[model samples]
Target chain A: MISLQDLTFSYRKGHLVLNNLQLHFEPGRIYGLLGKNGAGKSSLLYNICGLLYPQAGQCQVMGFNPAKRQPAFLRQVYLLPEAFHLPDVDIDQYVRLYAPFYPGFDSAAFDRHLDVFEVPRRQQLHALSHGQQKKVLISFALATTARILIMDEPTNGLDIPSKRQFRKVIAGCLREDQCMIISTHQVKDLDSLIDEVLILENGRIILKEPVTRITEKLSFRQVLSLEETEAPLYSEGALKGYAIVAVNRREEHSRLDMEMFFNAVMVEKEKILPLFTR
Target chain B: MQFSFSRFIHLCRLQLAANRKLYLLGMAALAGMLLAFMLFFLITDDELSYNTQQTIYMIGLVLSSGVFTTTIFKQYAEKSQRTQALMLPVSALEKMVLAVLLTLVVYPLVYTVICLSCLKVMNYIDIYWLGNPNALYWLNASYTPGLLIMYVYVQSFVLLGAIWFRKQTFVKSAVMICLIIIGIHAVHSFLGRKIIGSAQPANVEAVGQKLGATGISNFRYDGGMPYINTLLTASAKINGKWDTEYYMVELPRPGFAIMATVLILVPFFLWFITLLKLREQQL
Candidate 1:
């Protein structure tokens, strides 16, 4: 679990990137962190990981103050940074060197995951292609079995097939006790994967809820016109007609369009968040 | 209460893996220089030769120290390595302790072993110097524990410089040098003016008697002793080489050395705290 209480941060004095921010994450689900280009998504991640200290307020992960960086605290968490340049070390050796630090490291699971990703255990990391390297890190992060896994842009450089592979690997390895929060602009890659969604905008978490609840509360459907049909919650002009998202009242729940939902949240944060909260 | 040696060794192994080639090359270089020294001393049969071997040795010491310091910093904050290091699930103390060990104990031990082995081989071939062939002589006055501790301390500060400046360590080094030079000049000018303007004749006589005129001169008395004196400047000038009486007055003591060790470790501890405060976040 992670919690941020009134956290405010700035790289320099008086320039707040995050202001009076409050957010919480709990285990048992994968959360997709959605934000615009400069929505302080990375900064929020950094604050949670204890990489950047808040100018005021507090950030805690799993009851441990990240700033303290206790061995026990670190052992329970893992950060897969966006920068994918690993040391020019072979995979097996890299595992040997780094695995001891994590208390619950599963070397067998790591080897199995390496096989799953088809990452050659003998090749140097730098020699791998971008997607291959990403797979290597993903596989390694999964193997660490840290209670909290924070991944930034996890699907950035992956090819179409590799992205699917990434989803499969993550889903297969996910433990109910571990909470994985991934920040990415590619929402489509995480469709049907992330259980919960947290949308950040303008230094605040404007929306946070489970996908099932969101789908039931809001419906995404293609419509012929912008005309009101039972007062749709949101409508965006599409090519053939107007694409609208309304509060779903039907007995059956439809699959949520992550990209459309993300846009809706970004465009109509105030309207959509209150509907879910109520 | 304290970090485990096993953990330290585990981390040290990782550091070694990061730059094994450079470390091996450093060991070879140190060994080569030691061999060259043995060759020179063997031919001359003199411990203190007229040649600039000692000067070369001093230069080598500075260069090696710089390389060692840079290596320590880069292993922790190397652009290629920093991200992964930050991702590791270990305390900042573990990272710092491992860095210090790599810089001080591990590298020095490797160099010492290489140097000693080369000397041993040379002695077997009947090309020995320093005459005694006591392998333990490498632990002479030059290899004092205090010097090693001091070097580690300074290197740890540079390691701190690496983290604090991150990618701008070279710039940090330059800025530090500039600041130190400016400070030295300021302090030198202030003390110079004060000592010359107000130094009393009796104070000079008293200093001369206590530390001898030679020792007092090393203290760099520019002229008349100042009446108004600051203890910091006077203490800075109290060296004993040229100031012979001061040399006798300020002999080394084990108690002071112990205190100095604690002083040297303070910066490393502070840097360790900084590392803890600024860890890599969850992605």
Candidate 2:
């Protein structure tokens, strides 16, 4: 589990990136953190992983203060950053060097993830292409099996097939006691995968709602005209109609359009969040 | 918060495994440079003077210390690499200790061996191939206690600079280190000027008791070490022979404690500070 309360942080002295921010992540869920550029998404991940210290307030992950960066805490939490550097070692050497730190590391699971991604087992990491190297690291992060897995831009630089494979590997390897938070700009990649959504805006996480509850409270539908409903909370143009987010007063069923939902939250927060509150 | 020997060893293994290619290549380059310097000396001069050999050994040792210490924590410099380094399960103390082991212990040892080996090789070439006798081979300059102690002492400061200045680590560290040494010297000189005034007068009285008034003119007195018994010894080649002109003065029993404290204690303390700085590092 991860918890942040009144966490104010900034890279520079006076300019705040995350201001009085508060949120919690519990086990048995996959969190998709969505944000625009400079929305403190990566900063939050850095703070959680102890790469950046909170200017004020506290962040606790698994009963340990992340700022302390104790080994026990570090072993349980893995942060797969948006960019990473791999040493000049092959897969086996990489594993042999890094895997011992995590007591719960599963070599078999690691191999399974690699096989799923189709990463070459014997290629020197630096010699591989960017995507292939990313795949290797992704596979390695999954294999660590850390309790709290925080990934930034996990789907970036992936080909179409590799993205699908990434989703499959992530879904297959998640344990019940694990909490995985993936932050990415590509909401579509995390459509059916993430159980919860965390929207970071204006240095705050304004929305942290589960996908099921969001669907239960709001309906996402395509309409031929704007006047089909009295007033939709949000609408965007589609091929022959419009995609709108409306209050699900009649409890109609529809799959959540994460892209539309994020946009709705951004543009129509006043009108949209009230429905979720109820 | 944990310190396990097994884990530390594993961390050491990881550091080596991660940078083995660079380390191997660096060592190879150092040996090659030493070989090149010796060959240059053998070809250019009648024989490779021990002084030139000592110059190469000392200068190379100092430069190598700065270079290696600067890179010992280069992973902490960039964001992407910094993230991986900070997220590693090893404690900061373990990381600092690894840096110390590499820069302080292993590097100097390996460098000394290479340098001495190069000295031997050049001596053999001078005698066997070039028909030059009295070729200087061994370099004992770096092995002296004073030089060894000073090397570690300066290396600790350079390591701190490396951690503090991420960009242009070597250049910045060198500058910062030079400034600090200058500052310390300035302060020491100021204090000496205020307290001691002129040491010549005190030595003049001692010289008057031993030799004539003109004998005081021959002796040039510098500041003495802050120990109980101070040696005012001077060496002069008298009557066509190198002779020791002993003028041992026993003032107190606080012999070399200040120097010992500065050299022995300060480096360890600086290393501890390095660990603290590492612990506080953020991307």
Report the number of the highest-lDDT candidate. Answer: 2
- Candidate 2 per-residue lDDT, tens place, B1-283, comes to 4587878999999989999999899988999998898788767886777777787788889998799999998998898899999999989888888899999999999898888888888878777877877446455554666667779889999999989888999999999999988886666456444544434445555555554333444333333433223433343233354334545444344545665555467888888888889999988
DockQ of each: 0.32, 0.84
User: Model 2 segments beyond 4 Å from truth?
Assistant: B139-143, B198-206, B209-251, B255-259
Top candidate by DockQ: 2
- What are the TM values for chain B, all candidates? 0.58, 0.83
| lDDT, residue B200, candidate 2 | 43
Per-residue lDDT over A112-206 for candidate 1, one digit per residue giving the tens place of the 0 to 100 score: 77777777777887788888888888888989899999899999898888788788888888898999999999989988799999888778888
Candidate 1 ranges beyond 4 A from true positions? A223-243, B25-51, B75-83, B111-157, B168-171, B174-283
Q: Model 2, A176-196: lDDT tens per residue? A: 999999999998987889999
**Stretch of 10 with least lDDT, candidate 1 chain A:** A225-234
Q: What lDDT would each prediction earn against the true structure?
A: 0.70, 0.84
**What TM-score quantifies how close candidate 2 is to the native fold?**
0.93
Q: Against the hidden true structure, what lDDT does model 1 obtain?
A: 0.70
